[model samples]
Target: MSTTQNSGRWPHEAPPAGQDRWSWRPQLLSELPLIRRELRRSLVADTSDAAAEQEEELHERLVLLMDELLSNALRHGRAPVAGLVRRTASSWLLVVSDAAATVPPHPDPDRDPARGGLGLRMVADLTTAYGWCSDGGRKHVWAVLAPA
Candidate 1:
């Protein structure tokens, strides 16, 4: 039902091959908080010099980004949603996948700002790079956050 074109490789940049990768499959929306907690722990476990305030800020940003993508998959895309974070030396690749392989992500251009449909644009602004791809009957939406 979405008008978005089926551009399998939007932006055409591939996710990096990182030194480490963490992934989770959340079947319910209520599992987000726990997932976020685990993700935060993995992200900051090695950064001993990170200030408390900076850590908190990073947590907030991670929650916002993850929530937006996962919620979209839960609401619009098919189930069995998975979240992946690949950590390289200086960057992190965040990817969310759902079974809706044929349905591409649609960024509504005409939605009212007050009504809350601009999440895709917000994701684009927050990430250094972003794109989507369809592989193995799953649609993967990804973003790269550098200076990880």
Candidate 2:
């Protein structure tokens, strides 16, 4: 079984003064493992005592959500492009950038089972909320998880 320790809230002091309170940029699939590790570390480092159990469950859910989001991006978002995942004071955002300008169709529960289109539905269920945006040449699909 996986174990986790509660680290309080994310440190507001990590970023230099006057820097964007938020961090953002494009990311690659190869960076996902490291991102997961950093997210856990950030949680542990931020929380105080008495948060271990809560953190553990939150971490578990976050991992599963991340896996689902990334998998959907790779399998359906189309194009081998970069993405962005950001953590803010209130929520964790998973952003997958792709070349497709078309918005993803809403999950159809009635579609034929053999067509294989349940990933986003799972993502929608797992996350606190999710949506997508397009700009210039890229489409960004994002989901948010409330802070633990």
Candidate 3:
């Protein structure tokens, strides 16, 4: 596997230090629904004092972002895929890691939406900050969303 820390055009950074973190392993695509449910539950439990609608929207965005990154790892990266959610004072960080250190995220700006590779682009646009890094033979892709 390639040892390149951050192989793509995006910046490289580790998951931010936070108040709490949750981690899980996701090896199959079929587990997405369960993952989403658990993520929502966790968000609701550890959530802030934000307005109800805003909190719901944040949960939705986090779930969708996790789905995209975790699905990509399951479909293309080598197992076992790891997922993490970290809640900091100002943001929530979502990270997914796999054994495919040689294969970093590829975001094609010119790709057609119907071709279905636009998730990462949407993620980049939606998040406050996002990037990936390879460490200890695992490639980690992470995104940070404001808690608001």
Candidate 4:
């Protein structure tokens, strides 16, 4: 695969063609809370009260997106599941990586309401943008969301 242009200004050189700006492999589900806490610290913000509120809201959205993506990875992927999050000036880029190289599911409008696909559907609707790609045996499903 070739390098595609990223929509944000990240500090590192472009990822290895099909990878993200950063990555992590959570050892256990219990580590998610810690991950969230650390991610909260990585955020850039203003000092105003309004900015604080907006930052809070953005953090909440990031948490929700993280949950959905992680759950999907744990449920559908193979071992050594990983995750990634990048904080840009105007947005957050989040990704859940899995060992499975198979394609990630898209939002299916006609599927059962309570069965499957709702999570991906919610992800698609809630985020500014969403996409997935598999490089070799690693699959990365990612989303971009406004910071505020």
Which number leads on lDDT?
3
Off by over 4 Å in 4: 1-23, 41-50
Q: Arrange candidates, best TM-score first.
A: 3, 1, 4, 2
Model 3 TM-score is 0.86
- Of candidate 1, the 10-residue stretch with the lowest lDDT total is 1-10
lDDT of 3 by residue, 1-148 (tens): 1233223355666767765477779878999899999988887887676655678988899899999989989988999999998887888888899999878788777788899877788888778888888999999999889865
Worst lDDT run of 10 residues, candidate 2, spans 1-10
| TM match of model 4 to true structure | 0.70
Ordering by lDDT: 3, 1, 4, 2
Cα lDDT tens digits, model 4, 58-93, are 777777778778877877777678888775666778
Residue runs of model 3 more than 4 Å from their true location after superposition: 1-8, 48-51
**Model 4: how far is 27 from its true place, Å?**
4.0
Q: Give the candidate number with the greatest TM-score.
A: 3
How many clashes would you count in candidate 1? 0
Model 4 residue 65 CA deviation (Å) reads 0.3
Ten contiguous residues with the weakest lDDT in model 3: 1-10
lDDT of 4 at 25: 79
For residues 1-148, could you state the per-residue lDDT of candidate 1 as single tens digits? 1222223224533466665467888888898888888877766764566465566665567667877888788888998899887776766677889999878777766678899977777777677777787889999888777643
**TM-score of each model, paired residue for residue:** 0.81, 0.62, 0.86, 0.70
